[model samples]
Target: MKRISRREVLKTTSHFFVGAIAGAGLNSVLQGCADTSSDQSAIDDIMKKTEMADIKNIKLTVLYDNVLYKKEMATYWGFSCAVQGLDKNILFDTGMYENTLMSNMLKLGIDPSKIDELVISHDHPDHVGGAMMFLENSSDINVSLVKSFGSSFKKEVKERGLNLREIDQPCLITKNSFSTGEMKNFTKNEHALVIRTNKGSIIITGCAHPGVVEIVEQTKKITNEDVLLVMGGFHIMNDLGTKTKKIVHRLKDLGVNFIAPSHCTGGEAIEIFSKAYGPKFINSGVGRIITANDFI
Candidate 1:
């Protein structure tokens, strides 16, 4: 095995979105011969059978982000969140800079060694920057990411003796959580985390390249539950005018009760979401914590 630089990793991953578009087309061709409905039915049955503990509270701490809620915390062009109070302590994505991510995590008292699983939303450098650092600290953790992740990235995980699970379709990540699977549009391949609670389901995304509304719909299809909250990067920074507003309406129509847009979601888009969601719109940034009870 050979060591690869972060720059090389970034270079390789830069091709993912374009490749994903091509791959998605091929997948459609292949699925044309298969019974997609049966597959979906099986997934629904599995989702129904998945048992979750009666979670009274779920805590999500923003470990890395482009925005800062606490002045002492570091902010960067990336995203990461620490999810606790569930079946497993999951670390979602790793912000772009290793030192910054570790510093923020340390300031927040979040130990990477305690993470039961690491769910990466994609292979972008910002989303995966601290992955190697986290892997160095934790020995017994499972890593989940889209199956379309670059080979160099996968090789790094294998070389580090990390347990890696490649996700292609909606699958149960834990007793109470399911990944919305790999969703691709024109930009990148990403997956949103879906956690089912007594109140409803929560969707956590990283740079929603497939459209946030589509991600929510996919989660709904798998969990068959109303979305209690939809948080994370919406990737709508460049969308001017009525586009962002239409997306907000689409999410509302899909039964999304709350919104917390961060990172690449842009200031304008966040403002739009803030006005639309009103009190339900959470101010998310580094060190921001949201619990399950907050939704209720």
Candidate 2:
């Protein structure tokens, strides 16, 4: 495994979740349905949904996990992200192993009780695998664990007396944060986090099995803000020479400013991004910390 810093690992997994690969199985369903031509009108609508002044001092920290680092992280860890501020600490996804996630959080100085909310990106083990551990850590607080499905994990949560909200409908978590709520339109029952930030809306995804492109476009539809940063697994590593280039161009055309592709993103894709985005492309790894403050 590459010697990735903890901060790098954290930011890469800021959007950790399980999703299907685009053009692999669900491409036809996603491609034929939406007219890309209408994207401009949609952008306009998104801009109209909120005022720029509404965004404030929101800070996100790449907390724990591995898949976001591209290399099969040491097997001691999985993929997990910690979001701080906004009056709540929302943990997006948990890695495959509970011990690794817990130890990483401890080494990184994150307390589970400080986490006000827990959101699951999908049903995959890597994403929700550490839920029971998280709940066990925060037994004192009425922490809210949100997910689209009433996963068997729900039983574990309820059995432990943790508050679990099986979200079937889209709902707001904070002043400007929104959840995709299972994203039944796509496979893997994946969900992503859309956060309003000072620069613009930051969309955090896990695995992006539903298609990274589709995730970004859907976030634009829901939040109506120019995506400032998209950091997480793109699940597109097979052909970096051509496909990554196309995706980068599309993201540019869509007005995305920063991208930190990790986890399932192969080396070739990382190379393409490093050449294309340069400094804007972050190198993520376990034990590293990244935030908007660090950017400025």
Candidate 3:
């Protein structure tokens, strides 16, 4: 992990439950996602581990995605990212297949054992399928997911002695990291990751089911900072020609400095983004590694 004195971060357990925003309206969008006492305990343990570690540069490596940047590794219709330089190493999502996800991670020189926790984006096969394999074989590390997940899946995770953090609201993940809780709207249940950097915030989505533009807007509003970058699946594969023109422009309008659209972001949408972002566009795919320093 990398270290440097940070500007401001939560240092006590009391601050952990309040969430990225105390009451960011949500306008009842996340309706029916209630919480339990045990669920609260799970999240507490996951966030309290390394409050001492300072953040410097956050290294985000796309370990698994639909696009292939390095032909040496296998690509699948899924998404996963390796988050480094924080207090604990985090695997953002598990991808579609366990073997393929693991193979690509090793090919990229990432050690599975070094991951301290796993933050699954949603219940989709492409996102959570590979997780079962890792969770069954691993121990000690925490698995953070939405509280609305099926009981059988949660049962299996607890059976392995792996800590489970049932996320319901935006909360701290580690020192500078946070989960947008779980947003549900057009698609299904999903969440984005937020890493507070010195410049601004880096917001990562699994399949912006709740709307990519909305996610960026809410994060910027909650964090009180402009978004430096927005990466991961935009899930805009089905839009017609030029339909995404406004979305890309809206992102740029939202003060997003860099854009990395991968996974389900579709080729047409990617092209439009490239034209919109110009030099700031990143060809994000499997094996692509980006750091906060690269943009800063």
Q: What is the C-alpha lDDT of each candidate?
A: 0.77, 0.60, 0.74
Q: Model 2: per-residue lDDT, tens digit, 24-94?
A: 22111101111223435433433444333233355555555453432332333345778766656788777
Candidate 1 vs candidate 2: the lDDT winner is: 1
> Can you list the residue pairs that collide in candidate 3?
none
Q: Write the per-residue lDDT of candidate 1 for residues 31-62, one digit (tens) a residue.
A: 11112345475467547756654547588899
By TM-score, the candidates rank as 1, 3, 2
- The sequence of per-residue lDDT tens digits that candidate 3 reaches over residues 1-296 is 11111111112211111113222222222222234244354345434431422225578899899988877879999899999888788999888777889898888888898898788887776777677556556766778887776555565566556677777776667677777776777557777888877767888889888889988876765565768889999988998746689898788888999999999999899988998888888889999998744673
Q: Which regions of candidate 3 deviate over 4 angstroms?
A: 1-56
Q: Compare candidates 2 and 3 on TM-score and give the better one.
A: 3
What TM-score, over all chains together, does every model reach? 0.87, 0.73, 0.80
Q: What is the lDDT of residue 134 in candidate 1?
A: 61
Predictions ranked by lDDT, top down?
A: 1, 3, 2
